[model samples]
Target chain A: MMSDKEPLFSAKNRKLLTNPLGSDNPITIQVLGICSALAVTAKLEPAIVMSISVMAVLALANVIVSLLRNTIPSRIRIIVQLVIVAALVILVDQILKAFAYDVSKQLSVFVGLIITNCIIMGRLEAFALGNKPWPAFLDGIGNAAGYGIILVIVAFFRELLGSGTLYGFKVIPQAFYDMGYQNNGLMILPPMALITVGIIIWVQRSRNKSLIES
Target chain B: MNTQSNTYTFLYAAIMVVIVAAVLSFTSLTLKDRQNMNKEIEKKQNILKAVNVTSTPANAVELFDKYIVEAIIVNSEGEVKSNDKAETFKVDLKHENKKDLSKRKLPVFVFNDTKVGKKLIIPVRGKGMWGPIWGFISMESDRKTIYGATFDHKGETPGLGAEISKPEFQKPFTGKQIFDESGVFTSLKLVKGTASNNPHAFDAVSGGTVTSKGLEAMLQDNLSSYEKFLKSSK
Candidate 1:
């Protein structure tokens, strides 16, 4: 093992932060956390809020799991990870209710459902258990950011086409509507979110040849 | 230190549960008041919307006190049970809906405004396809014609059933009548197809058949329960 003298932002540690932002993205590449991606992407505001919420839960859960790695019984590890996740999710949900009531109302049960988000569980089991707390923290942030990027991109197009607005503002001009332009109704539905994510995956694979299998 | 032992696993789980339970309890207890205040503000805000008075979160409580001149609780027999603000505001329709008709504590808010005139507002609750749906419905002094209405849902399908909460759906309900020309209560109807020229009917949401039907039943059932009160007031 490398000495503790290794610089904090060493190349390996940097890769842990950067890899998930692109080639190893949690949403597009690993295909985790697509349920929330589809549910909240109808509006840009909710998508951004959800992304931040997931990121907070994931990073904290990672650090906690890493710290408890040695003492956690191997037989009950999954349950242990679940309890940490569920607790963090409830904390986030309560905070949102007290402070950001409107956004929390919009998110509804999806906030609580974060307990089931596979991305957090996958990281806790695969990465956090074997790594130091700092690297595990970085991995959590990177993966969640990767997921957020795809969510924001999908929300951008959906809100624009479906509602003809960005973040609830009128982006399309009145003149365009006068010329008989109508917002695409299909874009507002859940199926369109799946299709949008599929399109992103296609474009990403085409750009990065190394991602494709023979 | 044997991680694979059954005894260790049980002990680990037991300790983990205690810690998690304590943390969750502390959070819930600390934030309970603020969370409830937020909810109360939202309820007041929605009640204002039903009467066509817009209000922000910061001003909801003040405006509610201003516009809602009297918060009265009434029974099925059209008799006023209590006019206390705390008692009236605390009337939960979900719980009342589960009780017998004669024992239900129905809340009725009297909204007074110089520009909008006086109106009677009532709350309704029902089951949607996915979960519970509820809303406030306002009526003109005649107790028959709807003035303005607002609806909200727990977990309806976002694009389809959840459309009930939108302004467009609630707008059409403004001028509808709950009672016919003869004064017999014939609660509003939600027509599956076009409503045509019917004064007692409106079109249901297109793709949300179950939710639409549920909302229709909610309106009919709740409005009919107030029949005695409507006739007595008139």
Candidate 2:
């Protein structure tokens, strides 16, 4: 139990919020939810929308699961977590369709596919089940931000090089295309997403030598 | 309570399911109207797109009302069944496509714009590489050559098959004739390659062969029924 005297953003709690942004990153270090990374990163806009959706799902799922951690029957914890995540995803998808219709259309089935994203399950089983609601929420935000940052980075390069556009706006000058500059078609394909993630992993591991396995 | 007991697990599962179901159903019920409205607006926008009229979600309804001078539902025999705009617009093409062509309620929208002129817009539905693909194809006043087209897919591969929805693919459909010089219904074809010189076909997306073929078949199947209507209108 968190004591009344304990500050809300205590040092330990801060690490829960910050660690996943770098050294303990979910996508690069843990590599949990790579399916969506490959699926939605073709364009920058969908990637950003997807990142926000996943963050919302993850943070809420973490808090809910954490609040019920003790009362949850250990024998059926996984099922409970799945139910919560699925419910939240459906809610998000409905809300998106009602309000952000265009983005919802761009996302389409992938929002429903969020129920299958492993990071939410992994966080619930690992951190939320063991930690208090506050730390669980922080961890959720941290890991989701980690995933979002990488998605944004990959989408940035993909949209810029593949489509010569960012968020559907033409960023590369027409003069370049007039001068025979061609967008890299390969970068637009799904295979290129894996390669981009691979490069990010390689660069991160090389810089943080401790991340390398013995 | 023994949380680990089988009874406890069963109760927990049952209660969780009840809560989740309630939440989901409530959400769906509350948002159904707004979601349906969005879909209706998107359909109107797509219909307008077939005539090369650009519209945002905010202005789609107004533009649709302004540009669509008539919505006519016709049968396979080229006989008009209804001309009520709302009734024709609400005709669900996905369901209509499933019926025999003779029994289908095929909707035709006459878009009247001072600059773009009056064009006939028809809806087409077919399978894509991943899922259902549908689009609107607008024909010029000649009732032969396509004026504009707009295609959308449920789940085609992002940069490949899904390119059918992009302008680069749809733009080439303009000026493509669905009838031969003899006035026979040929339907438009998505040629596999090198279709620049072909007036009846457009180049298919390079990496989207299956989707291209599916779209081609869709045009053939959907447009053949409208042959009588097109000819009679002309």
TM-score of each: 0.95, 0.95
Over B172-225, each residue of candidate 1 has an lDDT whose tens digit, in order, gives 898888889999888888896666578799889989889999998999888888
Q: How many clashing pairs per prediction, in order?
A: 0, 0
Please, what are the lDDT tens digits per residue for candidate 1 over residues A97-166?
9998998888886787688788999899999998889999999999989989999999999999999999
| Stretches of model 1 off by over 4 angstroms after superposition | A1-3
lDDT of 2 at A50: 86
Model 2 chain B weakest 10-residue run by lDDT: B188-197
The window of 10 residues in a row where model 1 chain B has the poorest summed lDDT is: B190-199
lDDT (tens digit, per residue) of candidate 2 on A24-136 = 99999999999989988989988898888899999999999999999999977898999899889988889988998888888887898789889999999999999888989
Error of 2 at A184 (Å): 2.8
**Stretches of candidate 2 exceeding 4 Å from the true structure:** A1-4, A174-181
Worst 10 residues of 2 chain A by lDDT: A1-10
iRMS values in order, in angstroms? 0.9, 0.8
